[model samples]
Target: MKATTMKTLTVSLTPHQAAMMQGAVESGGYASNSEIVRDALRLWEQREEIRQMELARLKRAYDEGMASGEGREVSADTLLKELKAEARSSG
Candidate 1:
């Protein structure tokens, strides 16, 4: 990839996380602390995108369920029944 424009950032980290990033750079897996930070930011951004998509899907499902006029009431028995069904399917 071509080197892109730069952004300056400064932040503090826990000792353990700082050590881990330093070790990763020293281990030749990353060229510099900036590289490590950029990679981490990219991964976090991807995760945020995934979470947003999941939330949108959930909202759509909730809206559709409401439109279907299914009972919105929940009781202990209903919760237990769903849990039991999940356990049975997994086991």
Candidate 2:
């Protein structure tokens, strides 16, 4: 196993945030404040990765939609009327 070098960082937090971390340690769920901060960072990193992936997926979908056909402008009323007509005819 490879040894990883750890760096110490100083972070300033609000009283509420500080209390929350202290509570977690007191609850025995976490060994120390560092563990809580590391866990929170891991969750934050995961959420950021997911957000980037979703944005990329949306971009691809948008590109595909734009490439599918020519765009047309239609009012809500016109669209509703057209849809109703089509439904009536199909029925």
Q: Enumerate residue pairs that collide in model 2.
A: none
lDDT of 2 by residue, 1-91 (tens): 9998989999999999999999999999999999999999999999999999999999999999999999899999999999999999999
Q: Give the CA lDDT, 0 to 100, for residue 53 in model 1.
A: 100
Looking at model 1, residue 31 earns an lDDT score of: 95
Q: So what's the TM-score on candidate 2? A: 0.81
- RMSD in Å for model 1: 4.1
lDDT of 1 by residue, 1-91 (tens): 8997887878899999899999999999999988899899999999999999999999999999889985867899999999999999999
Q: Clashing residue pairs, candidate 1? A: none
lDDT of 2: 0.97
Residue 24, candidate 2: C-alpha displacement in angstroms: 0.6
Model 1, residue 8: C-alpha shift (Å): 1.1
60: Cα error in model 2, Å: 0.2
